[model samples]
Target: MPRTRIHNMNISLDGYAAGEHVTFDAPIGGAERLFDWFDGRVIHGVDRVDAPVTLDRAVISLWSQGIGVEIMGRRKFGPQTGEWPDDGWRGWWGDEPPFHTPVFVMSHYPHPSIDFPNGTSFHFVDAPPHEVLRLAQEAADGRDVRIGGGPSTVRQFLQADLIDFMHLVIVPITLGRGVSLWEGLAGIEDRFTVETVTSPSGLTHQFWNKNGHD
Candidate 1:
């Protein structure tokens, strides 16, 4: 069965996922250290030169596997807010985005969809989490739908109990003040079968699968 999943969600030890402020200059804000161990090439199943296959890379490589569509908040798409300005901002990604599938960007302000040559299409939508998931699932065409988040988006899906699988990377650091992933998500582990694997690089990868889900 098709599933709703989240992949490569990095969070601080204090449960913060992103930094306090996101701007066009600093997209990740103050939480840049959280992704120190990340290698974007591995998401496409590629390893670094002269580097052996590590556990962290092996796990992170699973990010784009079988993912047909993605649902993400507006912040994850760009630094714009409210009504989008005519900046011609496609996204943080350049001409080609890593997600070579339909991407539904959640925003209250509607805008025409943007398509890239690499098969990464960005569709703007204004709806609740569940409603957006429905649209994403339909666009998925039987493949899994990935929740591409910046903490707030993932928290909304988790609160609505709409996520089926998640790959959460917990980094050992404290942001002190930033966007948190676990806020108001008390006892969320009870709904999923949780497992953890600690890498030698000090990154703990937590896999959460909803109960009765494969």
Candidate 2:
């Protein structure tokens, strides 16, 4: 059975996964600074190449390692709101979208599925986490499903107790306000065994895995 996982999500010290005031210019919200730990490595989904095999690179590489389908909030897909303006907006990812698998964008408004030149195809759905997961799993064909998120989406899955594994990088900074991952997840740690490793870049990599599973 394929698992539901979250990989390489950067969080602020105050537990914000995304900053406030998200716009086309600022994708990750005000928490854009949280990703300074990239260290010039080639982003796996976007660049599709590895830098040296350092911890940052090693962990970043896993973002695309074994995932088949991706389920993300509409905000993660883009900064669009209301009805989609036009077909012109494919995504923030340009022609060669990084995700080579089927990607599901959870949205309130409906839109026809968009397939890019690359292997990525975006399907817009207005469904809850479990229903969305079922659809993604069917499309994945037994491969794992990744929850590519904007905090709110991830929190929904967490609240549903549906995530099997999660990799969160806690950058050493604080965002006073934003969408937080831990806001309503009071005892989320009890769902998985927590392990911590500090990267050379001062980011703490926290792995949350279910007991007796990877």
Candidate 3:
């Protein structure tokens, strides 16, 4: 069966997924102090990230290796030209994002298709979580589907208990305040079984799987 998973989700010790104020300059919470966890080595599968690709590049390629499409929130996808009052910012990935498969961004806004230098193509959807998941599964073919994040979207799928499995890296430092990833986790016990833990350096990795996505 095709599974929906959220992997390597980084969060702060104080429960902040991102810093309080974010601009292009401060995308991942100061990009240094708030994200010291990022510099740590990432182990993909049984091997560490030894590829020549950037971390973001590896994130897309490695995670989707056997997965369906990737899903992101409107905020994560950024604003399109003539699409927002503020400065028009496309995805941070520039012309060649690593995702070769069709990418789905969940939002109310729609723009013409974004064709990247690589075969990667992005599609904007006004659909809900379930609808997007269905489309992602198809795009994934028989592979698994992945829900990539920016806090709010993760909360949506986690709230509905639509996720199948997860891999988390609990970093060492703490953000006094910022966007939290584990908030609104009130009813997940009804659908998930939290299991397994690994201590790697200062970071702790945890895994969880759904009882079933019925």
Output the number of the TM-score-best candidate: 1
Q: Which stretches of candidate 2 lie over 4 Å from their true place?
A: 39-42, 45-51, 212-214
lDDT of each: 0.89, 0.86, 0.69
* Candidate 2: tens digits of C-alpha lDDT, residues 1-214: 6989998888988889898777889988867887776753335643455445677777777888678999999998888789988857888887888888899999989899999777899999998999999999999988999999989999999999999999999989888888889988998798799999998878899888977674
| Candidate 2 residue pairs that clash | none
Better of 2 and 3 by lDDT: 2
TM-score of each: 0.95, 0.93, 0.81
Model 1, 126-158: lDDT tens per residue? 999999999999999999999989899999999
Report the number of clashing residue pairs per model.
0, 0, 3
Considering summed lDDT, which 10 consecutive residues are worst modelled in model 3? Answer: 52-61
lDDT score, candidate 2: 0.86
